[model samples]
Target chain A: MTATLNIGFARASLETKLFFRQRDAVIFTFSFPIILLVLFGSIFEGDLEGTGITVAQLYSAGLIGAGVMGVAFQNLAIGIAIDRDDGTLKRLAGTPMPRAAYFVGKLVSSLVLAVIEVALLLAVAVLLFDLELPTDPGRWATLVWVLTLGLAGAALLGIAVSSLPRNAKSAAAVVSMPYVLLQFISGVYIPFTELPSWLNDVAAIFPLKWMCQGLRSVFLGDAGAALELTGSYELPKVALVLGLWLVGGLVLCLATFRWTNRGEG
Target chain B: MTTAIHVRGLTKRYGEVHAVGGLDLDIRTGEVFAILGPNGAGKSTTVEILEGYRKRDAGEVSVLGVDPGQATSAWRARVGIVLQTANDAAELTVRETVRHFARYYPNSKDPDEVIATVGLSEKAGARIRQLSGGQRRRVDVALGIVGRPELVFLDEPTTGFDPEARRQFWDLIRSLAAEGTTIVLTTHYLDEAEALADRVAVIAKGRIVAEGTPHTLGGRATASARVTWADGYAETDTPTALVRTLAEKYDGEIPGLQIVRPSLEDIYLDLIGDAE
Candidate 1:
């Protein structure tokens, strides 16, 4: 077990280097959420009805979830598919490296990317949009758990969804379409209140909705809860739903994951 | 020598296609064994089965005293596998990649030494994507041997290499074999088997058609040699005696005389043709 963990750390370090060395992937993954925040923040102005919070601030808060999901889920799914195509998984399998070590490496690298992504989004919101940073230690605590559970669930789901693409050449399109659609329904593109009740219900079935709700509880605090569909932060429900998805994602990964592309065996 | 790999009645089928049909092989320790065959002749399938990358439908197989079908981490550490082509780790420098993989083995060679052995010392800092195809292949070889494995499997390791690169690769394999590493290589190149393998097995139709030393495969060692002179050509079992008769007739060195045995390529073609 110790050897596996040690090798996992080694793989994680190598994976991190590879992740950053791809200049195009680094620029696109880090900047996509910030670009969206800037674009939407400029278009959606004024407060929502009687709420004092500017529309830009609501977007700034919610975009954090989208950014994390982008890094943890979309990036990983596509990256793993490429790994499968390029023979990275096969090479590693031939070695003495434990299978668990591969997952550990991926999880560690995605966690690093997600943190940077979240930090960059937060920095953009604070520097350009005049968004307020939370003063309470409790809010910071909420941010940590929310980010932890949300990312774990998203990363596991990414590993499972990676098997959906027929091949690595088509992985980007296969993985991205649903992720884009999820952002719209999950209130990252538009405020959750503006969307129809049924749309919100449908979004609730996925983890993205709960993730955004959890982030809102952290960044927007009490005022943010008033605009929520439940008229509260729904912290316990957020935890419960995200927790369930985390377990469900693991099951899906076991059922669906393939070390090699289809027909390779 | 003890057997490094022993197999019998190995079979693997994909739907109606028999990818690997009842094949048996034994590779002794410290010997460079080459499995020579045409494309789609089940070379890759059989190698994959021995590498523990594919399950056999029916077979009793053992590698380094462990059943490859039930391969363990310890068993894996003792074996190295170099794939036909891999485009991964493109973003990683040669040094970084080799060093990282070295950690996976319990007793690994020095990463820098392995890199140098594969003739990549000058390009150690270069990312894999920055290297040409031949250079990238050297990186694959470096990774395969850095673990100091007792056995190494190379599946068509030099498919696209230029002649010069192939020569360098052969020298590297020679040095590895000198250190007593049992190597199993698959290639369609007859010259490659002649140059590097201690024993060559010509596989066709998912079965071994011929197996022997490079000189003896398919009765090649004792095949009739062609004796040629300025005025005539003759194929005889004893070319030395034929050359002596020609020399006496000329009262000196036979005029324009040359004796040639069947080349490995000839024997390989004959063997596979017979199997077909």
Candidate 2:
């Protein structure tokens, strides 16, 4: 057990170094969410319709959710597929490293990336845009749980989805097309209130919608609650939905993951 | 000598085709054993099965005294494998790649020392993708042996190497053998087997058709030698006697004297041809 932990840490450190070395990917992942926050916050001017929170402040939470999805889902899924295609997974298979260590290393990398992204997004919003962060201890606790559950859910979903691609060469297109579509209904690209009533029902089936709504509660505080359709953060529902996705995605990935790209002996 | 690998009636099928058909073999510890065969000969499949990376349909096989089919991380640690494919973190420096894999084993060689052993010390800081194919193969060997394993499997380790690089690789394998590492290698080059292996097995149609020391494979050591003089050539079991008679006839040294034994490639070709 201790060996796994040590190996996992070593793997994570290696992954982190590799992740940061790709200057384009690093610049893009960290900057994309913050760029969205700045753009929406600047253009919308003020809170819409009935919500007391400003547009930038309101969208900050959703953008944070988007950042998590990008790092934990898209990046991880594509990276895993490429690794499979390139024989990285097969090389690791010959080692004494536990399979769980590879997974733990991946999860750890996603979590670290997610945390850095969220911190940068929040810092920009709070300092430049006057986004109101929650002062209450309970709400802060809610933020921690929602962020943890949301990142884990998305990352595991990415891992499970990775098996669908024929090879790493095509994995990016296979995963990103659906994800880009999901962004439309999930409110990452559009404000949840402005989305059609029918789309809300459709988006509610996935975890990202609840994740974005949960982030709004933490970042925008009291004023953010009114903007939500439920007239509240819907924190309990968010936890349940994200929790189910996290646990369920893990089961699905474990059952289907293949070390070798080739199927037979 | 301890047995590093033992197999009986091992079989695997890919639907209608049999990849490994009832193959059986044994390899002793501290000896370099080479499996030589052509493409699609099921050598990789059999190696993968013994490495605990593939499933077998029928057979009892043991590697390092543990059934590879049920191998665990501890079992894996004791066996090192350099796969036929070139695999490494492309973005990582050779040093970093070696150091990272080293963490997986309970007893491992120092990463820097391993790098030096594989002649990659100068390129240790270079990204793997920047290195030549042969250099990448050296990295694979470094990773394989860094584990300080009881048994090591090199799956076609020098397939892409130039003659000079291949010779250097053979020296490295010799050093590992001197340290008492049991090595099993697979290759298509007959000379590679002759240079590095203590024993060579010619695999064809998913079975070992011939197995013995490289010097004596296919009765090569005892095969009739060919005596050539200025006039003609004749096959004789006692070439020295024939040469003596020829020298006497010529009144000293035999004219244009030369003796030739069947090369390993010739014997290997004959054996594979007979199997087919």
Candidate 3:
């Protein structure tokens, strides 16, 4: 078991290194969020309505969730597709290392990268946009749990969605499509109050809305809490929803993941 | 007395196509066994089933006393596999790849020693993407044996190798067999099989059509022998009788006379044809 754990860690580190080494991926992962934060901060410098919080704070929380989703879901799905196409995953399947270890390694790497991205985004928000840290320790704890659960949900969703991409090139478009639509409806790019009523109703069914709402409760308090459909900051229920999505995502992944590229054109 | 591989009535179907159809084989410990056939003749499917990569639809298959379908970590660690295509770890050097794979096994050989044994000592520090095809093949070999496995599977390990590199690879396989490792190899190269395998099985259409030692496969040894001289040649069941006639015709020493039986390639092609 110890040896297996070491192998898992080694594989995870190697994967993380590969991710960071790619110039475009690194720029998109680390630098993209910062760019969004700057753009949103400049656009909404003063006088934002609907919710009591400033536009910068609302956008900051939303951008953090978006960045985490990008790393944990979009990056991972594309990576797994490429690895499958290149025969890396199939070769590893023949080794003594367990299949679970390979996925666990990927999860670890994605979570670690997500945490780093969140930290950088928050730092930029505080220094440039004059954002304040949450004063309540319990609220900060809630934020951490929200991020953790969101990461788990996104990672599993990535693996599940990767099966749609038959080749490495198609993987990018496949994984990014849902994310783009989710961004539009879940208030990542636009304020939730500004969206159409029907689209907002549909967005409520997605895990992203709950994640963004949960994050808002931590960072923006009661005004943001009122925006949640539940009308209460129920951290435990949010955890349960994310947990269900994680389990559902894993089942989807197992059912659809392909081990060989032989039959795929 | 122990058998390294025991496969009975193995069957695998890929939807409408049958990849392996009721194949049976027994490979003894410490013997180099080769499976030879044309492309898409179920050679790869058989190897994959034995390596525990693909599941079988039916049949009992065992490798080193454990069922391959139910293979465990300990079972996997004891078996080494060199697949047909080399997986790329472009950022990693040859030595790094070997060492990384070593960590997967419970009892692994030294990475540096394995690299040297595969004749890649100088190329150890070279990144995987920078190495030539033969050098990359050497890396694959290094990774396969780094676990110090008792049984090794080489799936066309020398597919892209040049003549000299192929010969060197043959020697390396021979040395491994000498060290008491049971090797199961699949190759299209008849000379490679003849050089390394103690016994060869010819498969066609998902079944073994012929199995025997290299020299005696498919009645090759007892098949018609061609007695040739500088001028002409004659084929007969009794080469000794033909040679005697040639000797008498030439008055003692037959001029440039030589007797030849069917080569392994000829017999293999005949066996495949017969199966068809």
List the DockQ of the predictions in order. 0.85, 0.65, 0.49
Query: What does candidate 1 score in Cα RMSD to the true structure?
Result: 1.5
Candidate number with the higher DockQ (1 or 3): 1
* lDDT computed for candidate 1: 0.91
CA shift of A230, model 1, Å:
2.2
Local accuracy of candidate 1 as per-residue lDDT tens digits, A150-257: 999999999999998988999999999989989999988877777888998899999998998988888877876788886898899999999999999999999998
By lDDT, the candidates rank as: 1, 2, 3
Sort the predicted structures by TM-score, highest score first. Answer: 1, 2, 3
Candidate 2 chain A TM is 0.94
Whose TM-score is greatest here?
1
DockQ of 1: 0.85
Q: Please, what is the whole-model Cα lDDT of each candidate in the order they appear?
A: 0.91, 0.88, 0.86
Q: Which portions of model 3 miss their true places by more than 4 Å? A: A1-3, A43-45, A50-52, A222-236, A254-258, A261-265, B240-244, B247-259
Alpha-carbon shift of residue A5 in model 1 (angstroms): 2.1
Best-performing candidate as measured by lDDT: 1
Evaluated with DockQ, which candidate comes out highest? 1
Estimate the TM-score for candidate 2. 0.94
Q: Across residues B34-103, which tens digit of lDDT does each residue of candidate 2 receive? A: 9998888889899999999999999999999999999898999899889777554888999999999988
